[model samples]
Target: MLFELMRKREGVYNEDRKERTENRPIEEATVPEYLVFPLAMHIGAPAEPTVEKGDKVKVGTLIAEKAGFISANVHSSISGEVIDISDQPTIKGIAPCITIKNDYKDLEEPPLYSEDEELSVDQMIEIIEKAGVVGMGGATFPTSVKLSPPAEKTIDTLIINGAECEPYSTADHRLMVDHAKELIDGVRILVDILSVGTVHIALESNTHDSVEEMKKILDKVDHINIVELETIYPQGSEKNLIKKLTDREVPAGGLPVDVHTVVVSVATTLAIYEAIRSRRPTVKRITTITGEPIQEPKNLLVRVGTPINHLIEECQGFRSKPGKVIHGGPMMGIPIKSGRIPVTKGTSVITFLEKEEAVRSERTPCIQCAECLNVCPVSLQPILISQAYENGDIEEAERLGAMDCIDCGNCSYICPSKIPLLDNIRSAKKEIRARQEEQ
Candidate 1:
């Protein structure tokens, strides 16, 4: 029933993902002199600090433990003493963080789970939860919650999302190229845990190298297959990805689980393998630091809590004074006003754009050119949503599927007038959700 469907849509093809880390090997960043573990790396409630200032810790030591079932644990990426536990610069602005000054010993903490024994579904869930795995694709949803779908949902398909669809981002591409075995192993574990019928390793056609690397392992498994997707923006969205791979339309305001499917980022899959086997927490991630402003753009195996300046230094500082430093891809990335912002589990790309590429042009009125609609991956009328939103018509925007806006930034990127359609839609979505909550 599954075949390659080349039905193109409202997505733009911009090759801004080149000239940097996509082709370079991932390098391990030197242990930063200091680390700052944000208590709120994942979604839901932030973790509570378990260690006070001045408490010596080792690599993998639990510093800020999960506060609730939906939260993720925060661990020390290096051996150090807690210098402070207070508000610090993070991707999401100033959030409480546990600051540790590295002792350089790189000491360790014991593994959370032993590999000598086989783990059942429940055991796997427990280990994954404790290991602090989350949606590394920037969603940062607790991975454990995802692995344990509701009893009512009969999940049948598992998709390993290797679609690094965003321009100027290639961390996942590099991961797929360098760590195919570990990625596949993670797929196997998820299949076993979820008891899914079939698994698909979906990669965009642009990343032929990654596709070739993964194709080598596809033959070893019967239920698992390689799905080469057309190079398109936001195809990595679970709904879009599922439709391209399986032709299943995820219901409005519903999750992929509603369609008996789950789509996890490939980086997250690799984390699963390492978390279960090596007993490592979600302490590090492969980040693509690129853009014309960077002197030596390359990918780095960055430890969580490393400062943005650490990467700037690793890249030999900026080529020219960067106009913007965004955390993640330019399209959907949250802007970091300062490089002091520490990297989190969700931090994927540290883009340093020159003023020419970074500065926003003066916004003109929407021309109804339908360019946004033409490139919208979700088929929603972005201008309509933005109009309703700007006019403060919350109900109208809600009716226009504002809540369904994936924040892909395609609408904003494609606007002829440089209208901030995505931002307005996002504002509308927040209001819509608030209205829903009030009910």
Candidate 2:
């Protein structure tokens, strides 16, 4: 596995800072006056709203039900009255949200997990599905579906990804530091569910303290081992992590399971533990709100539906005029038009770039420098794919393996001509998928 990654490695890519440097302890975000719950926080179809406007609700109340087996449930993280069931701005655009006015009473229905017992795989899956635990690392894939791999596929490895490779995103790092026990328990739960004998937890070597801390908590578990990885961007992506750790490259259009493994993130693991241990549904998550424009850089324990404005204020507001506000890290994160977007299970970092940092240069034509191919974590030729996309040749883009592009933006960062390689390929991939669906 190290053979491929070892040959070429850039310690830190452009457009990203290696260290977030805040290192502050987790702080509780102030409850917003209103909480907006987007019904479609997860990967699949949007959840169906269960509450109507004006319905009185408490914390942990089911606000939406799962629309399909691949969807996760949505709950009210605040005790308030349902103000409206209308389209609200989200990181993914305007989605239907259950708007609530916070009363600040925070009363709960009841404790969902009363006792702990040896749970069978079926029982474990049931609790996980009911808890609405999706991947908190930003993918937001339904965890239950990941746990329920096809029976024909023999899952041999379960890897816990703690590599906070995305620059300006250390939500996972804080989770490992403050909630190591929770992360470990989540890994153990996954161990039992997958029936995998050995578990490898991968963290960037920069986060050495996290490895020591997690090892101390999981020292007795012989089946678990810690794997330190290079602090490279996109190291946390499932396919990339699988290859770097296990020496298995998922074929084009293949999944981690094709290599008999499943890779999960540190935040996702902690979410799993919380859902099973406390029976707490996926109602909230810790997010990193940082950048050059913010007054204070913080890792906050924010409720699911809390607005970004609340967090910005909690962080002491902006220090300078904001140039661009990204929904995640600068590399793969999307730029948001506004800050009113509510927090969701997939929320990671709210990155604000200064005017200079957000500057977009003119694209001069591809220089064919092959720099993109060298820096691409997936080793795909981004220039060819971008060319294919620019020509509107979906077949050429498909032939160039556009779908294999991880959208890491490394190519765009490396291009001297300032071509938008990742964005172009991304558009082409979307069209390719739509064509496939049409067929």
Candidate 3:
């Protein structure tokens, strides 16, 4: 009964430019001589290092343990000696990082569970938690916590997000096309964990190859079906995807679990399968290294803790001097000062922008065109929130629903005056949150 409406909603279509790497087969990146593992890669408390400098670790060895219930464990991607543990630069600022020198010995830890071992719901959750799977679509929320919702919140529908809607990112697309059966089986694992009968794998209409491949593998699977979403920016966002497909509007400042649904990314789903079915931790992921400046754009299956510079080199280095290097897609990616930043579980795309594309236009006063409001997926008034924040009126901003902003950056992109509306709103939200915690 879901998706029958397909009601036209408010969204913007940007230049997807998926052709750069959607058709390119995924290339496995070479192991670097050294790797950097930041403890704060995922959301919530930073994991504490379980291994210290000079300590030996093998692949899949627990290098860092989850510090709290909200955090995730960190595993080694290569067998090596812990060279150092210190605060290192990351996509986010400096954080505690464990650096390792690769021995290339490929020593791996033993499996946590056997395939034939039938596991209960708690065992499956333990497998996911131990494997350190997070929302690989970039949210980086611990997957174990997401799957374990409060009992009062009855989850009836499960949405597997396959919509690679962001521009120039095809890691998820490549995963679906190359490993459709694995993705499907991964969904089945989630279905059993959540005990949900209805499931939908949402993909964008442009990714026909992924859709077709998934369809071929999921043939005759009555419990799980495919839903093609319009090719729109932020279509893969959990809240937006849930609303568009199920017609269930997650309340302001609420999560998908609050609305009787749970959303998992395609990458995270595959990680689930590997953690349970293949006996692996989330040490590697497929990342897109593409942009006009890249000499040879490609989708690379890279290991966690690999340097960004290594990925750039794998793409044949930049053809020209890049004006900007973003850690994710251009739309919502965080711009980094250097390529020394190591790849984390959430690193989906490393986009390089040419000079002309990276230049920032002068910011002018807003002309009151209301363009930002027109494109906000959550229907928040960014301009008003920004104004309230500028005026030191955090109360007004809070009342105007500043916390509801998804930080999708659509307001900044759509602003006629280049007002940086999203930045102001983000700061406001942070301040508001800080003040709330203080109280």
User: Which predicted model would earn the best lDDT?
Assistant: 3
Give me the runs in candidate 2 sitting further than 4 Å from their true place. Answer: 1-22, 116-118
Q: How well does candidate 3 score on lDDT at residue 390?
A: 97
Q: RMSD of each candidate?
A: 3.8, 3.3, 3.9
Q: Give the alpha-carbon lDDT of every model.
A: 0.84, 0.83, 0.89
RMSD of 2: 3.3
Candidate 3, residue 151: the lDDT equals: 84
Ten-residue stretch with the least lDDT total in model 1: 1-10
Model 2, span 1-439: residue lDDT tens: 0011222442233334535534777788889889899999998889998899899998888889999877988888989899999988998788899999999999886645567576678887887887888988888999899999998989999999888877788788888988888888889889888989868999887788887888788757557989888767767778888887788989888889999999888888887887788777777799999987889889999999998988999999988998999998887888998778998999988888898878888879776778778877777888989898989899999998998877777777767798988889989999999999899
lDDT of 1 by residue, 82-135 (tens): 999889888877889889998999889988876688887899888889889999
| Candidate 3 least-lDDT 10 residues | 1-10
Off by over 4 Å in 3: 1-9
Q: Candidate 3, clashing residue pairs?
A: none
**2 or 3, greater by TM-score:** 3
- What candidate 1 gets wrong by more than 4 Å, as runs, is 1-8, 435-439
How does residue 308 of candidate 2 score in lDDT? 91
